[model samples]
Target chain A: MSDRIFGGIGLVIAIFFAWQATLIQTSFISDAVGPKTFPILLAVLLGISSVYFLLKPDPEPDWPRAGRFAEIAFAALVLLAYGQLLPEIGFVIATALTAGYLAWRLGSKPLEAVIVGVGTSLGIFVIFKLLLGLSLAEGPLGF
Target chain B: MELLASLGDGFAIAISWQNLLYALLGCLLGTIMGALPGLGPSNGVAILIPLAFTLGLDATGALILLTSVYYGAMYGGRISSILLNIPGDEPAMMTCLDGYPMARKGQAGEALALSGIASFVGAFLSTCGLVLLAPQLVKVALLFGPAEYFALFALAFATLGGISAKNQAKSLFAAALGIMLAMIGVDTQTGVPRFTFGEVHLYDGIDFLVAIVGLFALSEVFIFLEHRGTEKDATTGPRMEIGRITPTWPMIQSCIPTMGRTSILGFISGVLPGAGASLGSFVSYSMEKKLVDRDGTFGTGDPRGVAAPETGNNAAAGGALVPMLALGVPGSGTTAVLLAVLLALNITPGPLLFQQNPDVVWGLIAALFIGNFMLLALNIPMVGLFTRVLMVPPRILMPIVAMISFVGIYGISGSSFDLMVMLIFGVAGWALRKLEVPLVPIILGTLLGNEMEVNFRRAVTIADGDYSVLISSPLTIVLWAIAIIGFIIPIFVSSTLRRKMKKDERDLTD
Candidate 1:
């Protein structure tokens, strides 16, 4: 994205935050400034900064193209799915699947990726849960 | 004498088999992390905090391990900078200016040895400074009131903001964003939910570990993915045939004065609240270049060039701890992560830390002493082994790093919600990186935001809502002056320097 568009987004966010800051409800009858003070001040500062960026946009950065964006988005999806499945499927299964997929995406062969993924997942679980005695989410099969 | 006596007790704690083992493990891991490009001390410490907690180590033992990793990484970063020309971390960037040249010339062994010894000298002397000066500094810290604290934090924000990013306004914006994030949960004084948006988890503040893991580790994974197939083989150059790992007697004697000068310089820089190892090493390298290498041989395999930055950075790491231990203010990103760990362990690090938790404080100091020694011992014979870490393909490494981050955050909060938070911040952090906004200020803003607010409120309360109370104290006035000057002087100096260079070019052309 161009610096102009980025700065525009920042300005919108800053203004929205400033409006939200005005909405914060304060119940304290203290002599000092309320909890709203800091946020409001921060919003004003951010708004000013956004104006500066809007006025003097930076040189165009080397952003990734579509192919790389797909890679990143896929990786992010894998992580998000991993988090969602963690409690349901357990640590070992969820970790192995996600890590294996990621490894494959990084150019590892299927078998090698699976072996590494499963091995790492199980190894970490054993170390953290068994040896260290920290509890990890268990699968229905129970370890 | 009292400091000596306390240090003796600290040694007793640190010398125990358990603490010693922890220190060794930290050093080993720190070296590996530091040797790897893109996994510096902050990431190393952040990724390990959950593991430290899961192991159920007490605060003191955890700190010893974590801090060992901190300085050990500083020592290990030189390995890659010398062998591969790619700095493993920011401080090591200066090392690459001279170190890679030395390696290409087949003086890799000598360069490695010089850097190792310099790192030891820097870390050791700064640790001595920590022991002697921390107590006195702590006494002075006790005199600070809310107004003074506000000014001090402002100074921290100003100096830190000015030093980090090229665009100071962008740095300040990032800091403001961090403070906004910090204010998300319920307000402590008013019991008002500020920005929680009615989420149940929002009652408690955002977890620092979660934010950090997302910001440093996961975003790093995204960045790694972007350049996965494009990595040049770091080991492709000349086969590094290091003869003797140790510097000869004459070589050691030659570096003594340079090491001493840079160590002191680095230590002072480290003690400042916003000046970190990168600045320390840069200043030391440039000063040495001007003083000794007048003929411009500093970057062309000069041994003193390697020695200066290596010593300066490691010394600065040790020096950075002084402010964190004495005043509860972190000087750099790594130390800010350390401060988070201390808070997670329910230990507040400030003036009272010395009086209340002497064992933790003293034990950490003693551990630094041992950790530095262990790093030197480990770096010499093991230097070759560490260089091999550069060979780990980003494909495999990025996934492992991501997995570690996932498990680490999961282990801490045990909430999928928090994991989601990490993922969101990871994307945000990556976007911010693309925008050229530095990440350090965000973390600093989050860490100090609450303290700044509390102190601001307290000062106002004391003066019956008079805003002038903030500038009433002499100490606060001085701090405010320093803060303003710190922000403006850098801009003025840089602009003047640019103008002078332009004039010189015009004169030459004429």
Candidate 2:
């Protein structure tokens, strides 16, 4: 089930943390408790919790089926690309693309999604960047 | 007399056109967001923080605006519960019990109006409670040493699971994960980098605000995607025609005592670390049922049933500010976001906040009272308009939520790196939520992790590394005992109180 998988991941991270804790080079003038102690303590807590999940896995979590999961993955991909594309495409275009695609994915008509996208992009740009004068990426538009 | 003077000063500040305008705006937007299904106070505040900051308000103005949103959202959450049978958040779940039933009986308008009044009663009373109680709590808190502070932080993490958390292990695991995340960046004391992985951005540690927006707001988008159009989307927001907006005078008279009693009860629950509004709502609804449901009419669209939870949760929401303001600990997850904003502003919360920034503190308090009256006036006439939020389906609404998170994070930091981390947290947050791990503790851990580490070192140094110093004082011992009990007892107790709270989770997931 998903519980054991999560536990396995948690335990690995906990061990990684504990190992990293030991690797921390404490300066000579550091206080009685250095950086390693709290992290090590936290690592142990994480390890114990992960073991609980491993030994006492709950019922199988109701994960979505293939198509829905693919949709989620795609949206996540869009968001991932969004972060990368922001500085390049600027906030307006990047936002429009992400917003439009998401709206379309959310069951909007193509034109409506595009409107939502462009509207969201420009709306935020005008309000935040223009009206409020907060900093946003100018990209090519230089607005 | 001193309290009155300070509160009067607060009123003087809160009444300014700019602050008043901000308060009005916050209440309006808060109600709109609160009525949206799947959005709660945490998401509401997180999504809108950029806007608050973008407006170029001072700390006092910003706090007033956001805290007004906080109160308004508590008022708005009932809209979905009554009209759509979907709660905006956990605290609103109790409202759905008797609320939707009343709506089905064609009393949706009455239900909305009644809950609004109840919310007003709860919020107004609790804001009064907060003004009277918080300074006293601050006096006691000033006695805290580093050890007691450490114990207090531990207590916060231990109890943050609240009544809705199904597993303590999951909460602990999440907290540790957060602490590990906090362990990234350079160690300030030793000048050693802990887990920088050779990235310059890692030197400042993962910003909690970025993490918050991602985990709460962005993950919400991903969750919407997974359930987008399948029968997994069965929990559709079905709107009821909100007929007959006002409750009869007799009905109001009947419920007056219930509101009065539950206000105090909810405030006490809110003041308790980790209990928050959900516990407040649950306790109030159940307690009222016990005392007055002799005919078993409590859940069958009883006016009192609708009134109890609304008031309790609202009161508890107001009450939750006590710890955050007095002890530098959050009373609920929503307050945690507020606390993070405070810290980001370099305004330390706790006893010193009262001493150093009395204007800000008192202004915020005065604004909460002002917000309470504004919400009552707003929710009554505008309940019909607020109900319109339920009509906006996930597809259109969700993208807006996503855009806000994207734009907000970007606009605030202008750092794509922060946005990138936000996406990771969003995706990872979706997975954790699906696994039933609570998100609040993870946030709390990150928010308090550095301070927890600092207090740990301070305590150790003060006691010359005896380590026994943690339990040396009575306050420390009491806090440690509470932490242990909070972490361990719920697993064995498994009371009906917890089971009923779980039922909401099942209904939600179903």
Candidate 3:
């Protein structure tokens, strides 16, 4: 049942890629098969293989447990927020929140997470910007 | 003779204070990351890739540090596997088999020390192999043409299939999909945009980092969410002492044969694309099982099993660099990250690297030596300290890891678009994993996609529409033969093993 869903998705994605490859510009290099050829070949290969696997996969292997999925979702969302805020909130503040959140998830005490998160952000700032002489943009928080 | 000169030049590059500092930093960071159970060398290297980009050092120096981290993590991973029973990565998985057993027997100190020594031996021996074999391999590589390159890629795909035996077809499909995705940017040939969907950022093509982080790290989050754990013992065995950091000379001597054999095996296997350190460790462990027990005393806390896999994995780490350094091809996903760095630096890695960039080459070689020594120093005394990382609750640690992944990826482009792609890739990657597909091949396929495309185009261009250019060159024919034969052999070997396994199962049932 799962296989059919994935196979269908794979087939659609393959078609999308095939159609896209056909539109790419191919002039920098010399006389050749051009850019479209490889992607089209890949699409065909994927379409066929997806069908094959959907028909016959190995004996079921254990998938990751439920908590793992939650953790992944939480991380992805937090990371998405981190990227959105870094430029506006500044590296130090954004990073601190990000770090603290991660530390919390990883098992640090609440206070410890905040401290470590803030400390890590400052430390990175000092090392990269001050010591290494790389310039990082200061966000709205101004630190 | 020629090799000696190169070694001398490499020494000159490595001995400098700046490069030495970079190597030490890389080693220290790598050890810390490796000691963490869930974070392996690949993530360590991947997470810090943006830093390398932001810092923008000379190609050689950047590569030296990155490669050093890779090498150090290979050694440092043993620390966790031995003390905590958590393998840092797939290669270290074998170490847990006997290492944890030895640790449970109150030999944590001995296990840690032995594994460390085994790692040093494996890495050093593989370096020797690289020094001896690289130039010769380069010369042989010079004979390759477009068709040969394609054939080499085929062999890589085949090996990936073999390694992922349970779902070879699915793995290939994923790989092919990755290759197609790589084709989304503007075509260099006719100036046409392929799959951009009108987004300007997509024109630069998919950044390898975005794909990798999504596939490996982000998906890891989802997987982790599914499997929450209960509390365990707070304390472990007697704390490791400084005196127990080094293996006894006699103990070292006893395992020399296993170490030596695994090093060679690991190095040889590592040179072939798609056959990463995981396979190297497995092959080595099996070989040790055969040699250590004429009558079978293996896997019952025998030090040979631990030593064999540890040595094999470390050596394979070093061996894997050969293709990366000499041929510009990565033997595994981690090295492909390095390849991306090289590309970003406008450094083309191929036969051209040695001829055009001597300093980078030598500096990297030198960094490897320093990096290994530093790893040993850092890991030996700190085994007890690092083992404590396991005590931390996954709840807190998971959040911080997520944050790092978020900040690191965002720090790169400062664009929400990249983050969005990351999310999509994460979900896709998770779905693929659920279907029993291997992730390495997808990354590998993406890394090799453009190369294959260009070469195929070039081959045809050279032939001027002639269909026989693929077989016209002797080198191409030879490579094609090797690819075909190499692929068939694995299938034949695996079928025999499968039959033997089934028969053994039936015997047990009766």
TM-score against truth, every candidate: 0.95, 0.97, 0.89
Q: Please give the lDDT score at residue B322 for candidate 1.
A: 88
Which 10-residue window of candidate 3 chain B scores lowest in summed lDDT?
A: B228-237
Question: By lDDT, is 2 or 3 better?
Answer: 2
TM-score, ranked from best to worst? 2, 1, 3
Give DockQ per model, in order.
Answer: 0.70, 0.80, 0.53
Cα lDDT of model 2 by residue, B181-220, tens digit? 8888899788999988789988999988888989999999
Tell me the tens digit of each residue's lDDT in model 1 across B94-138: 898778888888888888888998999999999999898889899
Report the C-alpha displacement of residue B107, candidate 2, in angstroms: 1.7
Q: Identify the leading candidate in terms of lDDT.
A: 2
Query: What clash count does candidate 2 reach?
Result: 0
Give one digit per residue, the lDDT tens place, for model 1 in A1-143: 36677778878888888788889886846447888777888888888888888888888888888998899898898899899988988888998888888888877799989977997788878877888787676767665
lDDT of each: 0.83, 0.87, 0.73
Give a tens-digit lDDT track for model 3, residues B147-239: 777766766666665442555567668678767767767766666777888989999888877887777777765555554443332233344
Clashing pairs in 1: none
Q: In candidate 3, what are the lDDT values of residues A27-73, reduced to their tens digit?
A: 66546576667778888988897787568645555655566557767
Better of 1 and 3 by TM-score: 1
